[model samples]
Target: MNKEARLSRLTRMALGRESSDYLSRDVDELTMVEELKNKYGLENVYRFDVGKNIDGFSPLIQDVLETPELLGLITGSLTEYPENSYQRLRRQLSLHHDIPPEWFVFGAGLESVIDHIARAVLDPGDHVLIPVPNFDVFQSVSFRMGASLTFMEMPGLCWDGNILESLCRKMKEKTYRLVWLSNPVNPTGQFIPQDDIHRLLSHASETRTLVVVDEAYGEYTDRPHAVRSASSLLKSYPNLMVLRTFSKVHCLPSARVGYMAASSERLRQATNTYRPMFPFSWFSLYMAQLAVLDGDYVNEIRRRNQERKKCFFNRIRQQDSGLETFMFLESDTNTLMFRHRDLGADALHGLLAERGFLTANLNRLTGIQNQGFLRMTLHGDAVNEKFLDACRWCGRHLFR
Candidate 1:
């Protein structure tokens, strides 16, 4: 009997949509470099191909990682569901956000949290609004729900009342079941302003739309001068759902830890339906618990990240010319997506590889259509200098 013939409609339907990219993946940097080199057949992929935040653990987190208690989590029994442990984690997160613990929902990462939220909110044939050129993981949420996704162009940092009125009119007409936004957007690395966010929340209130604000890169927005968190809106806007992750400044991408903040009732319901199959190990949870209250450490990271971003910008600019051509588009986040007129992202990726640096070609990403956008995860002065050197080399080759 043929396998296709043997399969039931239910089983076949369960496979849902297939991914265009991969059947398997690992988050390890070395493995990623190897995979990209093999698939693209490039040499010396010294830098990663995506926007990766620099991994820096403070002395507090470092000391905890070295202890026996942290070690115990890895060797411990996996079957025993640690409900109390998670409850404690939630409590700590709530205090950090200045909200009640019941408002939080933990997951493997923001990816799982967003997927579960989409499932919780959407039905078949529903509508979704997401900004263009976002993180690829968020699309999976809409994909699984069999929903229609509309990618909106971003209103830049100074979005005004006219745009807000136009947006509200659309929301009123379509009444989207869900509106997805990535604050300090991935790939672009700029923030949607607070006033603009408030207007969207107001619109969501009218439509009863589930507004998903993914703040995975939230910590990066906290500058040395001023700090802010969207979690502050939870009280007044019950429809607003926010996501935060350990992947960025927390330096726990492999740990796969993240959580969501919303009204207590919504999260309580979402917990039972969403399971983290690539679940957080006991080790990940334990480590998160240790650092949950380290607000000062998070601020220090923000200060350092700002310094690094400044260096990257300065190194790439035409200092004496002062015209600011070949600059990174405005960003408050750690990832920098710099634009070039002479080369498309795909061509630049190849040229950078030839010069022994690896950077992502943003041309192929679904919502991205325009060319010549090369993406890099901005790091400290030393690595930024190396990247600058490569850019200078590539420029000479490209022009001559």
Candidate 2:
């Protein structure tokens, strides 16, 4: 058969989605980080575009790097590695969350775990409801499974206030295969209030819809008065699945370690069947185990982030009084989503880069209509000053 005739119907269907230049463009933006150095001098640009890069190399990473004989440890880990390292990690998490070890499934990242769940639960043309603007992964996985998608649109800066009620009503009327949501939501940095989350979960439970919650930003929101993560409710809502990562909270994105928490009878069992015999690299697994053991480092980062969060916002507001800047204080995470009327998100992104500051351009991520909202990460003092100075520079020079 000719090459064209050799492909399955599924392949042809997927290819049709991929064949769009717009789809390819979105894929390119998601995967690649464009270098934005000096237009002429080619100087380094401080990236603020990624709202989630670690403020600094984590102490756990530092320990691995600083150890002169770390190679000896890495090479010899297999010799004395625990026979049940995953079980041990699960035990640690189980103790932390008061959950059974069997309820959790580990993966390379929350994203990979999400894919596994989609594979296990979805059938062709199943309905998937994702609240926008949200992490693109949910949309991608839904489409990959030949599931239909209906987005409940929210402004890029924050969630629509009626989302919970609207979602519950929708769930009652339709049998959705899955629902995806993020805490301290991506790009926007808005978090759903805890009470609303409970109501939504109750509705999903009654309807038997699979609800996946990405809590990658859980660590940052682990503040004294912040909204708590949905993990605490896992025991009550078997229908709920929480996706968390060391990537965002523990600052171990490169290690790509993440896990899923679900009830023993549902996602936990199905996802286990989908789990590979060899899920990820041994080195990553080793590092993840160590990260869990080092709770001190995670705590310190969170504490410092809280203090830095205030200073970062204050610095931005103190800039030129002439330019009106709107700051969204609704987020309880490390990222701050904001915008200025003088520059739309895309144009502002380029201008900030010109001054050696990188910011997450929300126009593309949040949908074309919300071209004004942009998000920035809270970083260490040095990086914060660079970003703050860039903002000051923009107010003085880039005003429309």
lDDT tens readout by residue for model 1, 93-147: 8767878887877788777787788778777678887666777666666766777
Question: In model 1, what is the error at residue 240, expressed in angstroms?
Answer: 1.4
Using Cα atoms with residue i matched to residue i, what is each candidate's TM-score against the true structure?
Answer: 0.85, 0.86
Report the CA-based lDDT of candidate 1 relative to the real structure: 0.70
**Candidate 1 residue spans exceeding 4 A from truth:** 1-45, 48-52, 68-85, 155-163, 223-227, 276-278, 320-325
Model 2 / residue 293 / CA error / Å: 2.3
Q: For model 2, how big is the CA root-mean-square deviation?
A: 3.8
Candidate 2, superposed: residue stretches over 4 Å from native: 1-5, 18-35, 57-61, 77-85, 155-157, 223-227, 319-330, 366-370, 395-400
In angstroms, the error of model 2 at 396 is: 4.8
Question: What lDDT score is found at residue 64 in candidate 1?
Answer: 72
Best by lDDT: 2
Alpha carbon lDDT of residue 117, candidate 1? 84
- By summed lDDT, the worst window of 10 consecutive residues in model 2 runs over 18-27
